[model samples]
Target: MAGLRVDFGLLLEPLGFIKVLEWIFSIFVFATCGSFQGETTLVVSCKGVVNKTVTAAFAYPFRLNTVAFSAPDPEGCGGAWTDIYLVGNFSSSAQFFVTLAVLVFLYCIAALGVYIGYKHVYQQNSKFPLTDLAITVITAFLWMVGTFAWAKALANIKMATGASMIPGIETCKAPGITCRLASVTSMKTLNVSVVFGLLNMILWAGNIWFIYKDTNLFNKSNIISQSPAMYSARRI
Candidate 1:
């Protein structure tokens, strides 16, 4: 017959909270990118010496598909444009996939850990595994890579759009219409995506710290329990 079970508080630690937060951030970044459909438009104005004026338009739109994607920013004047927006869109899509992988891993590990801990709490001699620490380290690196990709994408978009907006003087390529950029505007979810991405990166750093601290405390307790003095003290 078994007596009262020992107080294995480690099995009831707050590690699950971090796991929950991890999933939340991952889903948040994904959703922000998904529901976001943004476009950039540049309106060009041209004036002829005969007191007549004409206008041209250039638009860059982003599109994503479940099986494939493309980056197209065509101009009305048939001139090829910069590919910054393309790169930015690709980066966002990649980040979404990476975040999804991380979310799945977090859910699995958290569930397994909770289940194992629950079983151990009943004195079944079960033990928590160190796999989570490795997972954290791996995901941290992935997060970093994803973060860099996002930064590059955003930078490229800004540069491309700004450069394209500078519609310098142009001769009448078309019969009587000369065109120059009048105004440029971008409407996209890049702002929200960027904000969420930054916060996600910061949260990842915190998660690493929390895991280190918790594991350190756990290891120290084990070491103390194995100490000769402590064992003797317990005997007395």
Candidate 2:
């Protein structure tokens, strides 16, 4: 009779795919200026509560304060030499990049752990026992936290700034600016981010279960090897 064969591919393949997904989404999150060569639909539309006036404040890349000529004011001030960006814009932009860095770091560590698992390499180092389990657990926890904060982190700004799921006619918001949006706006980044966050939760959950199974398999194999040795000693 033929014996069964064990292949670690079942475990590693999914992890690889997960890494790919995370990498792609990380680009969207880290795209501070725009996704396509300095072009994006991300902007703030502000409306005055009293005057019902609107202003369109476009998003710019993160940078230190620079003294520059004022942009032509919507109030028709013909532009002035003033500081750029509002309070909300700077805060949100900074946070998005920070979150991107954290997620990318976690994803890299997870990739390394997956490599060690499939290759069965460096597994004997007791310096840090069960490193794979640690990686899986930490990654899952981070994913959980990220998903929980999905609303506040990514959704709030997109939604607040006139993000629409409908095919036509989108809107955006800012403190005192509003305008009729004519550009074909897109929210691909926010959509992908939400989807990625959900999948990450499921994949990490499966990873934890797989690690438990692997550990038991290892213990059983060790016992099976010792059984033949003990029998031979008795026969001697």
- Summarize candidate 2's per-residue lDDT along 205-233 as a digit string, tens digits: 67676554445456677889999999999
Top-scoring candidate (TM-score): 1
Every model: Cα RMSD to truth? 8.0, 10.0
Per-residue CA lDDT of model 1 for 118-207, tens digit only, reads: 534322322333455566677667676666666566556555444453343233243444433333345255555566566666665666
Clashing residue pairs found in predicted model 1: none
How far in Å is the alpha carbon of 115 misplaced in model 2? 3.4
How many residue pairs clash (N, CA or C atoms closer than 3 angstroms) in each of the candidate models, in the order given?
0, 12
- In model 2, the Cα lDDT at residue 148 comes to 53
Candidate 1 regions exceeding 4 Å error are 1-13, 45-128, 163-188, 212-236
